[model samples]
Target: MNFDKTELSDEELSRYSRQILLSDINYDGQLKLAQSHAVIFGLGGLGSPVSLYLAAAGVGKLTLVDFDSVDDSNLQRQIVHREANIGQAKVDSAKQNLQALNRHIQIATLNHSLDEAELLTLMESADIAIDCTDNFSSRFAINQACLQAKKPLVSGAAIRWEGQLTTYDFRQDNSPCYACLYKPGSHQELTCSQNGVLSPIVGMVGSMQSLEAVKALLGLPTLMGKLMILDGYTLQIRTLNLKKDTHCPVCQAQS
Candidate 1:
């Protein structure tokens, strides 16, 4: 579970030089990424690009969690999987591709579904959590776990021509958790399978999720406490403020 490298190699420096050059990142921020661990839930549409960009950005370790297998129908937006990976466990498929992307980073695959206890255990060591799952059940579970652990979370969703992004920096006292936005049972599962989707919309949201994760990892300013909505059809991006529900069950209990 601890695969952090002590230093970046010459090859890694060259691969990440463009980002390292940023005043916000510089060498210290890149080093922060090299020492961070991000646990990601699900390996479907949103997860695909989130994991890829995290690896390409040099996140030291990734814990990919999912129980489903790749299907022929997933190719449209699940960029991490291909025709060759059909029928393969999603976590396994994602691990294979992530390793291919960055051998220096460690990829850990959880091929089974996680119970609440299991999720809390896995998240204990994660610097951040990424929610890419398609259902409210998984999102609530991840939110609770991250809140308990005081870990940051980057969440993304996409359907049709719209994409949504949010971050919960649970380390902050006043930050809003997912439960602050949608309570349990308030959501009816609407999946891409039936709701329909545009491929690039999911990819765009996932990429933004990756960007948020990187910024969090580097201790830079991020979208925490804010919601970003992307209207791919109109090519418009909107940012909105969010307030924590003082009565939110999960967040209220944190105090």
Candidate 2:
């Protein structure tokens, strides 16, 4: 039901044939994915699914950033790492898994946190950045990099059975950047270690993040102007329209 043999090789046509079946994501759309680069921040619960899906979908290049090493605890939800990778750097572990999924694409790893200048440099070559980090500091940093670079950022967060998804298309004149929604250092940080999270909650949110990233890469319209929240306990989801904060310290200057 997907693309026929014209634009792609028999092997490639067979690999992503299923997705190419969609009217909106036919042969041309697959080509877009084949030519794009994505940089992802963090490689934990959320990053696990996001990276895996993007690789499977044939995103041409991926740069994974994470300084943490895997532990026995992460095995429960961080599905990309194996028991053998328990002490390996997260980016290293993730690179192995993603490369194993699709040897045709490129996977690069950075086993360290990026400072502002470093992030901006990485974002410059990236078509989009995915924020799969856990805390506000990393989130705010990634947001700043994407906004400054005029690239799209697909962000997902999950803690204690609740999750949220949103994208900031810095290309848009009035799109609400992440800084408009949450101020840095204003809220106490939350961690899964201190406050437990249901495994599936992160999987759901992270998968949504991957979808948003793909849509942005393809120049397709998505939940660019709304925030989606999921209540894992109740199994209900809500999407709320977001308004740009004219007074937001970070976004205000951009406006």
Candidate 3:
């Protein structure tokens, strides 16, 4: 793992000048990001910003998973797709957008649903996993896979101006899993399709998710054991401290 200085061409230096100006993520951090890989589930609202930022930030590889195609309804929040990509697969559209943003990175598109086996394969090479999916099934599946693989997971959700974020790192014995906060089959949850979401709300949360992902990949301290809730209507931010549940189905069996 010799992370020597990556020789940035003149064009790359000019392209990433803004990031290079930052003390926290100078040439070294940029090189680290360029060597990292991230898996993003869902190419919807949250996925849009998450993918965009990660690509622009110089992540080496990005694996995008989505089974849906773009439709007129998704334009309200899924910014990655446009009228030209209306009928194209979401993964395809996202890959195009990400490449256009930064062609230096590698973008892998998974135009299908993720099952346990598929997830395990993705996790094998992923440095971090991000849950941008709107459904509980996908989110829970990602959480379980992250736990099993001992990887860090950044989970985010938004619906009608309400957004929430949480990080689960199973490397720690007492860190909570996604199931600790939202139990499986506990209750029916509404998706963006059922309850509309504001376009920028998802952008805000998704960008935050990207930030957390970079932090996790860089081995920096992150919001790993906390739940951040944002109320767009009220413009208020709340942080809830979280703990691993001893009886949580996901964490319990592992412990």
lDDT of each: 0.90, 0.89, 0.87
How close to the true structure is residue 4 of candidate 3, measured as C-alpha lDDT?
A: 44
Better of 1 and 2 by TM-score: 1
**What lDDT score is found at residue 199 in candidate 1?**
95
User: Each candidate: RMSD to true structure?
Assistant: 1.3, 3.3, 1.9
Q: List candidate 1 segments past 4 Å from native.
A: 1-4
**lDDT for 248 (candidate 2):** 88
Q: Pick the candidate with the highest TM-score.
A: 1
Candidate 2, which segments miss by more than 4 Å at Cα?
1-7
CA lDDT, candidate 3, residue 131: 94
Over all chains combined, what TM-score does candidate 1 have? 0.97
- Per-residue CA lDDT of model 1 for 117-156, tens digit only, reads 9989888888999999999888999999999999999999
Assess candidate 2 and give its TM-score to the true structure: 0.95
- Per-candidate TM equals 0.97, 0.95, 0.94
lDDT of 2 by residue, 1-255 (tens): 112222556678799999999998999898788778899899999999999999999988899999999999999899989998989999999998888889878888898778899999999888999999998888888998889889999989999989999999998888898888887777889999999999999899999999999999888887888999999999999999988888888887665
lDDT winner: 1
